[model samples]
Target: MGGGPDKEHVLITLFDPEPKDITGELRRRFPHFEVTYVQVSPSRKDAEKAGNEISDDLWKSATILITLFTLPAKPELVPK
Candidate 1:
């Protein structure tokens, strides 16, 4: 409970069909950091219907997060 500010949590999201590959890339890029991949299916009617509300929930819990996209020019998708 007293790890200090040096210990921070980072949340990352990928807006693409292949979350695994995106996550792997992140790991490679940031070898010293710990990464957790959240898989969300846009094709899922139930999830798509919920929209940003779900993303908002995840963003609230994240400390320092980054969203990696399949298309480099498509803009990095943040949790917000």
Candidate 2:
């Protein structure tokens, strides 16, 4: 979506897939703006690598990064 000079676009990256309730909350909180969810394949060995590549592409495309955080995994940190 295009933004005016006074407005700005924001992108938030969450390591974990957001729960349905949380997504609904976001929709309720920001009704005027657009919201989209991108589901990356966690089952693939290169999922993280692919995500990093895509993030880099987005950054190159002039998308602003507001925040980035990874979710905690189990003690073993097993891949899906």
The best candidate by TM-score is: 2
- Candidate with the greatest lDDT versus the true structure: 1
Q: Give the per-residue lDDT of model 1 (tens digit) for 50-79.
A: 334345544444456554331111123332
lDDT against the true structure, each candidate: 0.47, 0.43
Report how far residue 57 has shifted in candidate 1, in Å: 12
Query: Candidate 2, residues 12-53: lDDT per residue as tens digits?
Result: 444457566876786678665334444444545544553554
lDDT for 27 in candidate 1 is 72
- The TM-score measured for candidate 1 stands at 0.36
Q: Which residue pairs collide, candidate 1?
A: none
Name the lDDT of candidate 1.
0.47
